[model samples]
Target chain A: MKIYHECLPCHLRTAVNSVMTMTEDESIISEVVEKCMQTASRFRSYDSLLEIYYDIQKVVKDAFPGMDPFSELKQNFNKLCMDSFDEYIKKINDSSDRFETALKLCLAGNSIDVMQGIKMNHDVLIKAIENALKQPLNKKVMEKLKSALQKSSNILFIGDNAGEIVFDRIFIDYINSEFNKAGHITYAVRGSAALNDVTIKDALMVGMDKSAKVITTGIDMPAAYLPYCSKEFNEAYDAADCIISKGQGNLEALLEENKNIFFLLKIKCNVIAKILDHKYKVDEVVIEAKTAS
Target chain B: MKIYHECLPCHLRTAVNSVMTMTEDESIISEVVEKCMQTASRFRSYDSLLEIYYDIQKVVKDAFPGMDPFSELKQNFNKLCMDSFDEYIKKINDSSDRFETALKLCLAGNSIDVMQGIKMNHDVLIKAIENALKQPLNKKVMEKLKSALQKSSNILFIGDNAGEIVFDRIFIDYINSEFNKAGHITYAVRGSAALNDVTIKDALMVGMDKSAKVITTGIDMPAAYLPYCSKEFNEAYDAADCIISKGQGNLEALLEENKNIFFLLKIKCNVIAKILDHKYKVDEVVIEAKTAS
Candidate 1:
């Protein structure tokens, strides 16, 4: 999945947004976008469509210099999601199908992403979570996951963003309570800061320590780019019986990988939207079942 | 008026679109977009946002070599407008305020544009013209124009695109009947092909020559970049009694000029949309009165 012409504009916008967090100087933002555009144009092809974002991340890092541009945004987003933790937990507990409800909550968390440059406050997050809860989801995927857990032991749940990871922890709690003997869940987050993707520190901060074993892939990409992953993450990937990949980034990275990977994400961006044969938006919950291609 | 960061993506898209029309070879289209992206990145600033299109136009020309990328699109759009020419004329004649009716018809024609990459067929053109007529306009500007025409001569009407110019000709006919003393309405078009903008050849083909003196700026820009305009066009600009600039391109070109120009355009693009405090679209009729920065 290379940078299609449709994707170039978004890359510019995302680059602008990332640098904007570092400084108010429009000149610097403009220059950052200018450079990103130049680099993006020369691309023969990328590892995946999501690799276009790495091009933007590189330029933002160069301009800002060791600063995590989205740090404050990530913190705010985390706090925003944290405030709703009790409400979300109560909602799940109240639902008849707690497992499916928890899964939907996790899908809802995918919208709390800043990649598209939308400002997501507490109200927006709550509304998104509520909306995702109400929407119909593929029941077959939920059944498949349950059946897989019955036969499998190692479940690697790749977490996406910071605030969203709290919701992932909720799902993990539900799984642990229901399938305690089925598998041990290892939550893999981003190794470092790329966009607003969570790391081990974020997982611990969000109290994943109480729910599951949280680790990082040792690569900052929002996805598990397996080649760049730490030996620990690769070993975990190889050993995992059921791989629950979160977000479009991980979906892009592991699209063709030979594994029992259930892509649990809200369809974001046209590239993935078309691939999934769904309408393009951040709201659509896509739970695709695939074996290592 | 400088190129906004928002404009970069459109350039890439338009560049790709221009090349795609030339060949289905994705490699060529991708290469053309790549080169365009590089060229566009180096821009310190442009005269206006519209000037950025010139860069795209240059790359398309370079890649395709003498092929007018918009030629087939231009022909289809021209025919689309021509199909409804008699209908528009009849509707104008049947209207109570024929002058305003004709002006709105011309505004409606502006949507038959290629720059935004909308596929304008005959049905779309008719619907647009109808919609433009039914909507309320800034009648104060219409009143102002009537007063200006009362004192003016040499009404240098700057035409926009090929098919859309059919609507402009209808307005020209109305002006000839109403304000015959406003001197000869010299219709100026593009000297050569740039996007779907009309040239003298297009004006002659569309019968604009019969209604008024048809001339060109001897430049391929969709707008009158007065700095790059021919001596003939500049003299026409200086000597004109009143300039009825058609479309957003001409409006962008002569926004703060010394002459009393009535910008008769359907506001296109965000740059102009922000400047005029109009929402971004091609539906509204904006008749702005400006002179001497």
Candidate 2:
């Protein structure tokens, strides 16, 4: 989706947060924020928020070269999730509908976003996971997704963040093991670091390859912009019969695409909520499907 | 006080709010916001937030010429406060310490700021007034101000908003009638409309001239930037034995000035709170005095 007027302030906030993660020097932070403001001023209404965000990220990278500010936090979050993997798996297995429980778990994991400004500690994540399990999802949509998984031969899952990948792995494993009709599953991550988004290393560390083939989108931007994707990713995207797009970033990048995709995310901002016709509010879990055109 | 890094996002928010008050056209809002961002980018760390805000206001004015977007709201708020004027005066009269009670009401009226993002309705203002009266003020500072008022021959009262001036007039009236030692009183408003601030017309409309000599700062900025003030205002400010600087804007503009000024305001943002050495939080009543150098 194109940038909304509200997105400019959000972009500035993100720019400030991103720079703050790298340094504590007031002058440097001020300089980077000023540069980001300049960058934001140059943007037109037609620009996607992801594109604008990418440019802001570039400004931060230019200031602090060779530094992934979120790396340590990402690793800490991954370990936190990894420690809870067994408990989540047991809960899913004990649930009445394992598939639905696993899906909710994946949505719960979406709350571990560093850029969302909510302090994401272990206690907060646990509370979110508990809430997500009890939170209502559209029954019709869940049934539709289940039927699609049963019928589709090829599945592609686009991952979002570091800690979220662990839950995605659990969900993918459930589908791969139980759904005989579900064929080859391909998992896609961002080519490089983008706001704690999972890369090939995170996927490998989480042992996602045990359930599905792991690949990168070859675009450093947070979202899967089709034009910038690697040839291999495009081939996989085209070949897949069912695609699971995760998080607000991917939802924004592919919201207008003519593809058979199911968006599973926790809406985190008013911009996304408005784009979704105000059917969802921030902190609500969204399970929506878009038919192939 | 100089601008903090956190103030940049606030400036953008203020810019967006300012433009939004004028028009609903998305393109125009986006254009104006972008222009404000560009203007904000040019600000130095030494610049006051009031100066940054003034420049952003200029951008909005340049877009929508000859329009005072806040005029109608200002009038509505003034009437709202005027309707409750008798009741507020009764409350002060009923209190044992009428001077302190009147001063508390003045601080309570400071909650009617349009730029603070809190919806300023009659109900909200009433609640704020009730809370402000009950909220604590530093006893030492109050004692100092009372002692200062008793000795000062020339008193300068800087007015902030339209609705607020009524309350200020009540406080000034109480002081003038009750304190025999208190001397000539002067009330200063913004020369022109500056974000719903009290102007000459508002002062006259609210009968502020009855209690004190009404004058304008001759600068349209929300804060009283001393360098840009009219010769008349500067003379009044210099001659005054006690200057009552009202609201956060004026407090920010004159926080570092070596004057016998008592800042009577409700701290509205973390920037102001931090500048005051974290002794106050947002929405707290502040009665602080800065002695002459």
Q: DockQ values for all predictions?
A: 0.46, 0.56
Colliding pairs, model 1: A257-A292, A258-A292, A259-A292
TM agreement with the true structure for every prediction:
0.81, 0.87
- Per-residue lDDT over A1-293 for candidate 1, one digit per residue giving the tens place of the 0 to 100 score: 45466666666666766676688776876788778877776665665555666766777787777788777777777778888788888998899998888888988888657766567887777777788888887788788987886667888999888788889888888888888742388989888888888977687778887887777898867789887789999999999988899998898788778899898888776667866765445457768888755
Instruction: State the TM-score for model 2.
Output: 0.87
> Which predicted model would earn the best TM-score?
2
CAPRI class of candidate 1: acceptable
For residue A91, give model 1's deviation from the true position in Å. Answer: 5.3
How good is the docking of model 2, as DockQ?
0.56
What digit string (tens of lDDT, one per residue) describes model 1 on residues B193-293? 88788887678777888898887987888889898899999999899878888887787688767888888777666567877765445446667887655
